[model samples]
Target: MLKPLPDTVKGPAMRLQHMVMTFRSALVDRLVAHDPALSRVRMGARVTLSILISIAALIAFHFLVTPLPSISYALAIVLSIEGGVAVRDRTPGEQLKTRLIGCAASLFCISLAALLEGYRLVADLAFLGVILAASLARVYGQRGFAVGMFAFISYFMGAYLKPTFAELPLAALGPLFAVTIGHLVRTFLFPEDWRRDLRAALKAMQGRVMDILVRLSVLSKEGRVTENDRTELRHMEEQLKDVVLMAEGLLPRQVDGTAHSDDDPVTALSMAIFDLHLSAESAIVQSLETPPPFVLVHAVISGDRDLAEKVAASTAVEKGGETARASAQALLWLQRSLQALGRAAGKEAGGLASIDDRVVDEPPTKPDFSWKNPLVRAAAQITIAAGIAMIFGLFLSRERWFWAVLTAFLTFNNTKSRGDAAIRAMQRSVGTALGIIIGLAAATLLAGHTVSTVILASACVFLAFYFLQVSYALLSFFVTIVLCLVYGLIGQLTLDVLLLRVEETMIGAVAGTFVAFVVFPASTRSNVDLALARWYDALGQLLDAARDGESRYRVIELSSRLDAAYRELTVAARPLGSAWSLVTRPGPIRQTLAMFLATSYWARIFAHDFAEAKKPLDPDVLTAIEEARAALSKAAARGSDCFATRKPRPVMAGNAAPAFRQGAAMGADRVANLLNRLYPA
Candidate 1:
């Protein structure tokens, strides 16, 4: 061997490797926490790659054939990005059809806008009509939504670029090229495979379960579970719940040549995972004096069945106090679940006999045009906001007025309430502000280097799309940088131009926020109440099914609905954590959030116990459930208090198993106490 490396070099190399590993671990944790399946990450990459390839193709075409307008290139990039996003969860044929429609709509809008360029007053009036029509088109479902977006963007591009009649034909090529490139990339490079995705999700869930088990094992061995450990365990439990829900959502409703039963292997795997999680939580909270079966933990992690059985069988002996006994019981259940999980995983690996693979078209339904319709309300809100933004933006800078309108329209894209709109607007402004500082420095440093500028812009596009789901602020920041690079390339880069962008962004945000609060405002409280009503309804059905000993399929279906409803309620109640909501209605908002959380937690535990127990409810427990259901129905109907006048007494039955009794009693007691706290006499 050659001479050994010096300590100086080796030390730094080791440190660098350690740093890299730490960073990678942190990034993985964050992504898994936010999106366990990594679906968003994949979509972002697909869109970014499509845009980059489209840009490269345009550059090559420009040199090889007749020169193309800069606006044409910009339009092509935008269409490509939108097409990538629109094709998700669709069949190849549907993707192609959507792309074709988007292209046609874009071409028509571009030509119309170009033809109307000289007529300022009529053009402005037509713009408002376009906004109204685009919003209304959402009644047609996803296709209509895509068409509306393409039409609006194409028209905005036409007005902003002000293409002449002679350039219209060449400009029309943008959407065509974009459609072709986007379809090719989506079909060939990133085709959707439901089977592969489901399997990967299952694997990810298993890995996360193992990680939690490892942590719990270490804590058990130490004989001291700290508060921090419990909190961390709770967080892990929530993340695992998200992953399980996602996996279940991906399960095929009907497999070919096989009865679509709820007793599928994947369903079994999910229940096993949930059971293990429940056991882990119990052990952690009780602080097990006896360490977990080390050999069994190793066996599960290593997939060694023989050792697992030996350890699991040896741990059947009861030991220590009540807490220790509880912990031992949890460990015994965990072992059985792990064995069941292994069997399910093995069966799933063999794959379904015949997947249906058929894409059923949803029948067309009548469009709801009433004022109460969400689509109608959204369109009206965005149209009003855009109108206000356009007026103010014209005063600020007539040529760049579309920027403000774009911001205002996008602020309400997915937002439902005034609080959401305000938060989105605030994020956009803050993102733009930070972007300006970074953009200035970047622009100055990369000046006089066209190649470097192009590369930097492409990088920014990738980063912007990657963070689209993770953080709106990050997306906005990268998008602003991309705009800065574009301006630089067009010989229009200046401090004044960047500053004007900031001013326009703020104006647009304020306009959107104002419209959200003033015109047909959707309050956060109302949204939360609606979500709560839905969740309560689902929960009531699930309780009835479990108590009445309905079919397993019915219980599973109702449980899935309950999970979905809880997710919606979570989203709706998010605004309660905002400083504005807390400051405005501190007591009620805080109490409502606490009650929602407490109810969800206990309800989940109760559902899990009943699902596993598979026994008819005791009479006392049935009566308690019926009382709880009636109380919940009244609370949902009233949209507020149900226990203001009198509270129901807690019920505990001795006939049920200890676990079932505990779950039922605790769930009822927690709900009653939290509701009283929320709506005290």
Candidate 2:
């Protein structure tokens, strides 16, 4: 018989059990997040096209024609793809064009690197030139990025093998055949339309926004909201909106037989929805962060029918007291946002204007070419890394030298941040090791079975493309297996070759990491101040707009600011978090960002309160507002100085106005708290 448990023991044990259960549930939820755009059926279709031709050749030839040729072509077809680089993107035609172009360019570069291999001076210059070309190709967008990658890989292989003149033609034909087959298979056989995916993303975002709005409506009725009532639902809404914009950017740009007309209007509608959601979030946050009145909440609920009806209903509530007036203004602002969203989805979708078109002939204009551009600087840095790595590769491992240079070029990925380069190099090293081991195992097990080799290669290619965005380690694993099979079919698999390849890759990875960290380190920490400044400026602009009674432009500015500030902070934080040093981390920047976001929430409410005023504020309150604004600005400046200098400064918490502690006083206190937290001792 079990004895009765003590109350103290039971209570804590039950609480611990509940926590473990909750954590387990959350873990499962997170595991299934980010659903794959392609269904298993669709993936199987892609797999069939990728390998069916090779299998047919094997069956028809019956060993008459060697499996090596078809295998090489199959490898090319599998690797050369738009989907191989990015995901859920609907630009098959564009990818085909860029990949094919890259294929041709790579063939030329590979041949050139081979012929000039003996001449160190000439070959080095050629390598530099091709690398530069690859770097600049990114100006053309994703297609160019693919081209750069393919070209770099080709050059690496050519330089590594140092093939004879007789071997060049065969080398060129393999990729040409693969590219032809890949395009045919992708274009005619298993065509993917991204419009459906885009619609799903848009609907998902809209649904989330509607849910948040509904929740806020219910909460508003309670009329006594605490700080905990403010949820991260707004942050989630922003993330969803970001996903929609990112998906839109990946849509097909060219007008061809495959392009759909309906996508244009729908694309516009998505952008409008994203834009209006920004304002809606700001307004709703103001109303809910500090509850206004039940009348305003009712106005929002009542106006949910249509734009006109909502606006008219909000106007009816404006005639009450000052509290009711502020609530009415917020209701009108939110309702107008909802109306614009409806218009965007309905008849006026095309008329919902934006600064840029969804699809354009030319790439968006960026800053003119300068060394200041991270790409240009990276080109210079990579050139040096390659040149130095080549020397080590030639002297230490002449036959496998290309692997080192390839690693150096591949490591950077033409992306910003040294931290990213370091991380990528590490991933590649780990992935390649696992991939090579598994690939060799598969080849050995399936030896002498040509059809088996083809089947496994095809499956590996399928899985590689599917998991490309999901994990670099997984991609590297599959890619290595496919290449190992192709090479094994050519009868080139040997212990010596395997060991040499591994050694060269390791060398390259170390060299690449060294270059990223030491020689030309562009620490994101240096840019932390600039990112903070951008956030501050955006918040200041929103406050000014609200104070000036320009709600439309104010909301627009707020939306743009939300996008810009968040993007900058994200860009800065990723690298900072991954930084090599313990001191140089994102913790500080994230802390500052959190405090700013919190302080700004109250500031937005304060702005709306003043903006909705029909008459001038009392002199006493006006004075209080001015003092509070100064304190907030001063806090921002101090935070900037502390980050730049890495020294603690005195913290100031703006004093609350004795008379209006719940209004301006409450907001001012938050600003002061932010200042203290932003640069704590």
Candidate 3:
């Protein structure tokens, strides 16, 4: 059993850890400092967009159909599916499946709604009923909600349109054809294949990392790796996280494309190379904080020829007690991976981009879900949503569909905070109002004529697609105008219709917001805390792995932990309160935590870098790292209170070599100086 540290030690340790986190957060903040222009450009202003060509085809449908009844029904189905898909970061297959589910469910629900019309009160309650059902459905996960949304939208629209059961077939077909065609286009004609494109990007990132590594080796040999190079390397290192995320996101779409086999010569070699690189990085960061062996540093500071012959070759070369033979074998593997990638790209182009070579048998875990009871909980949720919608429908306007829409939107994700939910609600309300205003204006201007309205509607559809990435608001604005204008052209723009839409939208938004706020709000703070815990856990794992020495599993596990921690940190930073503390409190707490976490990450890399430092000259570097860890541990125990006030104690020389001790001390001093400069008095 492990003994716990005393409060005095624990307090400082936590503080030191916190400080490290702060430093890393600050670095990230500098990199991604928010810009309104960038957000607008990135979001693509396309909120009003249906499944791109899905909406486009809908326009064509309006031109073909004389009455326009089927068009509205189809549009509603499109909207439901689009809304569901929008929330998820979907792979191509998933996206297609979601759309299909929405289409089918909507059709069935609407037909059922028509059948139930005889029960006038239940018929009037259709909209609100769906809302309740959808809200309850979402607790089951994205897939559940996806199916629910289709059913709810179809039922609500069919009931409101007062369509006969027979009309449901036509309503369904319109959306089905449009959606199927649109997905084919998205899958085939998009600028890149989702998985393939992402893999290509990952390969490019690997190349970049390799280039940085080569440069580092050369710089170490020449003693010329400057602060600028270090900074650039750090930036490049961060980008690897992005590439990994992209690869993960795309992998689900092209599972078959991932061809890396356990026995595949290239894959095994690539894995080894990755481990070595990480080891090198860990060593460098450790050296920055503690004195590393002179030989290890010397190998880096020496020229390329020396580095290639010494540190690089020694670290990467396989060990069978035959250094040259191992180095040759390792070199051959690296060459093969690079050559294979290049040849694959040249011959098959898109096929090379798909790198889902590794098979993962189990599906990834759902990120957030906490239920006291599973079946009971789900039933309770369904009861609440349906109950609320029924009460509203019965007591107020019988427009039950409003309840469903509200329930769907509010329950979209297990939110981290009420504030986030509030923000989304605000966006929805604003978007809806803006859309309504635009629609009304377009109707009034275009006048009540089918031919002219269809022409104008098509133009709006085109523009909406072009700008969907800009701003959801802008997209919604255009869509609202087009649809309303078309309704007006049909001579159906009575004050009643306009008033109903506004009322329904408002009702849905308000109800949804309330439900979201009332439901257990997931706080970003908790996630941050969890991430910090994981970071510490990762640090511990990395240390153990290093101590255990040369094992492929150990190395892979370390890298995986590092990747997971980085992702968690990134997520924490995105939400408020996670990283804003640094900005709000730029004192020692912030500064210290920032430095500590950054150092921790660097420390892990340094450990990796010293993989080849088993030679006699490597002892000095290893001693320095040990000394640095001790200092950090001491500082952490003190809660970062006197990081500036107190001086770090000198490392004790046990079996440490004299030259190594001297080099390690020098390295530690430089790092201390850097920390002092970064924090200031």
Candidate 4:
């Protein structure tokens, strides 16, 4: 390096390097966000564990069954490991519940599928029924998800494993055995604490938020903001939003007989977790354009307890610019909230902040099974798709029609939109093809050895779970390899089988994708708009709660919900944010989004101030808020129509006044502007 560049060039280079680092951070977070040790667990360690388990399982069970069931149990072990490993594993009870239900449902489906194998018409109809039933499983929430997943797997195995009628019904027990072993390994062998897991998740999220604040402080020191800085800021906003949701999800569930008294510290902390996230989100938004002094912000982010309290004491009444005040407030609230969380978690204030106990518990309610439910619609549509795929599969190869049927059953299983289905279809095809190629090479390279097969299968299974949620493509690849290796374990891995698997999957996946497009197709754009519209509608409900003046907590709680929904809607419509950004300069759409954000900010301000008010708001003020809610609701409807229908709605003139309500009026104006821009008057 002969010479250094000017500040201009150096700045850009620095920004590029920072952006790359941020991207790397995002990737790393995606890979191991759910579990910390998972990312650190080396490939060698995984392989060692796999080989040892294979040796033990194979030696014991080799005489009873061939490599197939032994490998199946190993598969279960890997699944268990995916749930939890060592004592670092968290949520043993929840994992057990999920595994138990999934096992039962899977076993039943496998048995039923085997029974229906000989009856071609009846088999097709039965599969259709299973597909629909799996789709309808969403009504039960987490239980439903587990059941649906196991149901699909069971259906796939029963349909494809080709268990002969001569074989004992014991064949159906393979998955049951696999899942049971998986649960045992996860719960008894490598148990995880749900509260600890939740606590860890929360702490990690808090740390990330701190990192963001630190980064912001460093940037603020430079005193010059660039487009790259803005981009990075936006990325931080998004990441924070995601992490906030993740933290909320980790809140300890109410357990029966727990000391969840209203005044209990843990109970209050659990409830306040929602508030923390909302406040943190609001803080992130506030700090983007304006940051406080680096020292002040840094002390808070660093969890310097005494220093943070000093900063809060000094900054609370200090006369400063609005931006500086907002920044100070954001940092103070973030610190206080996280500190409270730390104390409630019964851990070091800055060390980990993981909860080891739960104090809140509520009785469970019966699940709704109404036909009008979205889950029912999902079931009906998915059944139709599966039926179509079955017919297509028979057309492709009656001998291997199960593959096609399996693909259809898998595609629409849990996807919320046509884009999701289409994406899965593409991912499955590409991943399967790549995985098959790798499996074929492995099958050819080392086909006869039991240890080799198990080892390879184990590695694939581990990686499959590793990338399970991180990337569909990678997950599909490893899953395909594991499936093929399973075939190899049975001494049936061949070119003909591999090619047929790929071909039939393509057929089935393609048919399911087609059905996804044709039958009740959910467009991503439309869904986003609808979600946003619903968010706005919820805002109205929030104000109504506030206006009812019955309880201040209701108002606070509703406002918190509004904040959370707004964040969700913002995340959901990010693609539109890209298009809305292309206008090159500040424009109506851009302004509108900003106005909506501003509306949220002002609304939060009102709620925050109202929280301390001893009496209800004036009637006139309540009337003003009601009027604002109605106007905002109408604007949302029109915006939805503009998106849902390819038609534009005429803007209606509406009266608006109160300063706090002006942002809502502006939000309406932006909606109108966006409608005109996208659909035209």
Error of 1 at 344 (Å): 2.3
Number of the top TM-score candidate:
1
As a whole number from 0 to 100, the lDDT of residue 99 in candidate 1 is 85
| Least well predicted 10-residue stretch by lDDT in candidate 1 | 648-657
Give the Cα lDDT of each candidate.
0.71, 0.59, 0.48, 0.60
Distance from true location, Cα of 531 in model 3, Å: 4.0
10 residues in a row with least lDDT, candidate 2: 649-658
Instruction: Mark the 10 consecutive residues where model 3 has the least summed lDDT.
Output: 650-659
- What lDDT does candidate 1 reach at residue 374? 78
Error of 4 at 284 (Å): 4.5
lDDT, candidate 1, at 596: 59
TM-score of each: 0.87, 0.64, 0.57, 0.72
Question: What would the per-residue lDDT of candidate 4 be over residues 1-681, giving only the tens digit for each residue?
Answer: 113333554577786776677677777675555454343234223433534454465456645764343324433443334323221223566666776776677667766877888886787688777777777776777667666766765666567655665442445345444555555554454444445555666666676667677777776687555668666766765565565556555555445643334454444554456546545655655566565666777787777868865765574426656655766777787787777766755633322244344434445777777765656666776777777777877876777787777677667654666656766777788999999999888877777887888778777766775565566688779878877877887887888888988888898788878877777766656656767776777677666766676455555555656667767655455434343222223233344444455555556545555554546576555656656665665566566443333322222111111133332233333333332333344
1-681: candidate 2 lDDT, tens digit per residue: 223444555577786776677677766444323432343335545545645563454345445653343324433543444323422234566656765777777778767887897897888778778887777766656666677767766765666556667666656655565556556666677775455554445455555555565666666667665555554554655555565455444444444312333335543454465445545655555555444445444555455545434443555445555554544555566666666666655533233233232353553576335867766677777877777678777776766777778778778774456676777788888888988999889989988999889878888877776675566678677878887897888899987777777777777788877787777677555555567677767666654554454544243336345455746766565655555644464455455455555555555445434433435555544554556556558766753554433323322111111234555334544544554455446
Tens-place lDDT per residue, model 3, 415-513, is 444434444445555665687777787677767456667767766665554455434456556666665776686677766766665555555555545
Q: 426 in model 3: Cα distance from truth in Å?
A: 2.9
